[model samples]
Target: MIYLAARAITTVFLLVGAAMADRTGEGGATIGSLSMRWDGQWYWVVATAGYPADLPLDATGHVTQNAWAFMPLYPVVARALSFLLGGQYPIAAIVVSLIAGYVACLALYHLLHARIDRVAALWAVALFAAGPLAALFQMGYAESLFLMWLFLALLALVRRRFGWLYLLIPLMGFTRPGVLAFALLLALYGIVRWRHRASDPLPARQIVHIVALGLLAVVVGFSWQWIAGIVTGDAGAYMKTELSWRRSWIGDDGGFVPFDGFVQASAIWFRVWGLPEPLGYVALALLVVAGAALLLFEPHVRRLGVEVRLWCASYALYLLLVFFPQSSIFRLLLPLAPLYGALALPRHPAWRWSMLGVGLALQWWWIDQMLVLGTTFTQIP
Candidate 1:
C-alpha cells in the first residue's frame, strides 16, 4: 500500500507541478482544467451528453469527429461518478484515473515480482512510474483505468484464474481499441500451452476452457464496433469516425494500409532532407521490422515469460501497423507492461540508475511540452 501510494502521489505532484507552470505562463488554470484539456475534454463531453445518433458529417459530406470513436467504458464510469459528485465530470474522471493509476502500479509490481526478483520488480515499477508520458496517469484519460484492469487481467492469467477473463476482457475491450492485443495474446498463450501439453500444468479440460475463453475474449474485444454501428444505424460508423482522426492529416482516402504511419513519416522526412521519399520509407520499414524482430526474439525478452513476450510482440506490431508515429504514440504504448519486464533485467547498478535518471528527465520534458506549454492546441498529450 505504501509503495502504491508513493507512486500515485509522486505522479500527482508531477502533474500538478506541470499544471502550475502552465497556469503561471498561460494566465492561470486549475489542475482540474489541465486534466480535462485534451482527450479528456472529449470524454467529458461524451460522458455528460452521450454520443450523437448519427456519424457527424462536415459540409463536404466527409465524416467529422464524433465521441462514438472513443470507447464507452471510461465515459460510462465517469458519468456515474459525476452524478454522485454533483455532475462534475472532469473531477470525476480525474479521480477515477488517479485511483486506477495507483492500483495499476500495485498490481503491476506484484505481477512483475511473480516473474522476477523483488529488486527487479521494484525497478520496473520505478521505470514505469517515471517513464516518458507518465503524466497521463493524472489526466481524465482512460489510460489509467484501462491499465489497472489490464494489469489485473495479466495477474489473473499468471495465476491461471480463468474466471476473471469474463469481466476483465470485456471491460478492456470497452476501454481501448488496443484490447485486440490482449485477445491475441491470450489466444497465442493457449496455443503454446497446447503444443507443450506435457510441460503445461493445466489439465487438458482446462486447456480447452482457456482456448474457449480466448475466443470469447476476442469477440468481446471487437464487439464495440458492432455496438456503435447498431446505435448509429450505419455499419461503418465506427470506422468512419475513427478514420477521421487521420484522414485529413495523411490525406489518405485510400483504404487502410499496413504501416501507414511509416509511409507518412517517411514522406515528411524526405521533404525535410531532400532524399528520395521511397528510399526513406524503405529504410524506416527495414529498421522498424528489425527492431521489432529483435525485441520479439531477444533472450532477455523471452525470459519475461511466453505470455508477456507474445503480448509485447502483438501490441508492438499493432502500433506499427495502425498508429501514426506521433508524440501521442508514447502515451499509447504505456499499456505495453511487458516492456517493463525487459527493462527490469539485471544490469550494472550505475547503468540502471542512469537509465532511471534519463527516464525521469524525459518525463519532465514530456510534462512540460504536453501539459504546461500544451494548454493551447500546440501539442497533444
Candidate 2:
C-alpha cells in the first residue's frame, strides 16, 4: 500500500511539475492565456466574466453563447480560485487546470490499481502523466476537467458505486458529450445485469437496488439534453446541433462523403486538408487501404482479445463519429492512452514504451505549436 501511494504521489508530482514548468511564455515569464490560442481566449474571457447572450456570433450567424464555447466545470472552479487569489483569473485558471490534471493522475493510478496488476497500473499512470494528453491539461482549456471527471467516473465504476455513478454521469454530460456514452453504457449494464440475474441468489432489496440504479443512470444520462432544451427553448436542440455539425461535414451532400455509409464517411474525415473539391471518396479508399494494412500485418498489430481489440476499434469509431483533424489522431487519443497500451499485441513492452516516447515527442511539438485545445479544432497558432 505504501509503495502504491508513493508511486502515485511521485507520478502526480511529475505531471504537476511539468505543467507548472510550462505555464508561460519564454524566459520563465508567466503568460496569461488571454492572447494565446482560441480556447484559451474563450476561457480567459469567461474567467473575467460570465458568458453573456449578446456575445459576437461567428460568420455562420450562430447565437455564439459561451455555452457552446466552453464546458462549465473548469470555468466555475477557475472563477472561485480567481476570487480567492486576489482576482488573478489567469493564474487561477492555470492553477486550477494543473491541480485538476494532478488529481486526474492520482485517480488514474487508483483506477488502474483496481483492475490491472499494481505494476501495470503504476506504469499506466506514469505513461498517462507524460502522455500527449498531459500537454492538453497544461493548457487553459477544459481537457483536464474532462479527463478528471472521466477518471473519477471510472474509479466510481470500478468500485461499483452506483449512486455516485448516477451523480457523476450527469456531470459527465456537462463536461463533454463523450461521457454520455459511458452513462448510457452504465445504464444498459445495470438493466442487463438485473434482467439476466433475476433468478440469482440475491435478495429482493438487491433487485430493487439494481432497478433503481438503472433508472437513475438513464435519467441522469439524458438530463443534460433536457436542461439544454429548457435553456434553448427546444427539446433536443443541442443534440440536433451536435448531429447537424456532423451531418453537414459528413452527410450525403457533403462532397467527400461516399455512399458507403458512416464507415466510409469516417474513413474520409481525417484526410481533408481544406480542399475545395470533394475528396471524401478518395479519402475513403485511402483509409480502407490503411485500415486494412493495420489489420493485416504492416503495423503488425494483433486483433486478439476483446479488451485489446475493442479499445482501438471503438476509439476509431468514436473519432469517426466526431470527425476532426486539427491535431493528429494520436494526440487526440491521449485521453485514452492507457487503453491503447492495453490493446497492443504480440507483447512488445519495449515497443509500447518506445511508442510512448514517440508520444511525448509529439506532445512537445504541440506544446511548442501552442495549439493545445478547443471544440473548434486545434493547431497551435
Task: Give the Cα lDDT of each candidate.
Answer: 0.77, 0.54
Q: Give the per-residue lDDT digits (tens) of candidate 1, residues 119-208.
A: 888888878876776667778899999999889988888888888877888888888787778777877788788788777666976777
Q: Candidate 2: deviation at residue 194, Å?
A: 5.9
Error of 1 at 380 (Å): 1.8
Off by over 4 Å in 2: 1-36, 54-66, 191-229, 232-332, 340-349, 370-381
- The 10-residue segment of model 2 with minimum total lDDT is 302-311
Best by TM-score: 1
lDDT of 2: 0.54
Query: Model 2, range 239-310, lDDT digits (tens) per residue?
Result: 444443343344433323323344544445534555533566666567757765554453324422222233
- RMSD list, candidates in order: 2.7, 7.0
Q: Residue 345, candidate 1: how far off, in angstroms?
A: 2.4
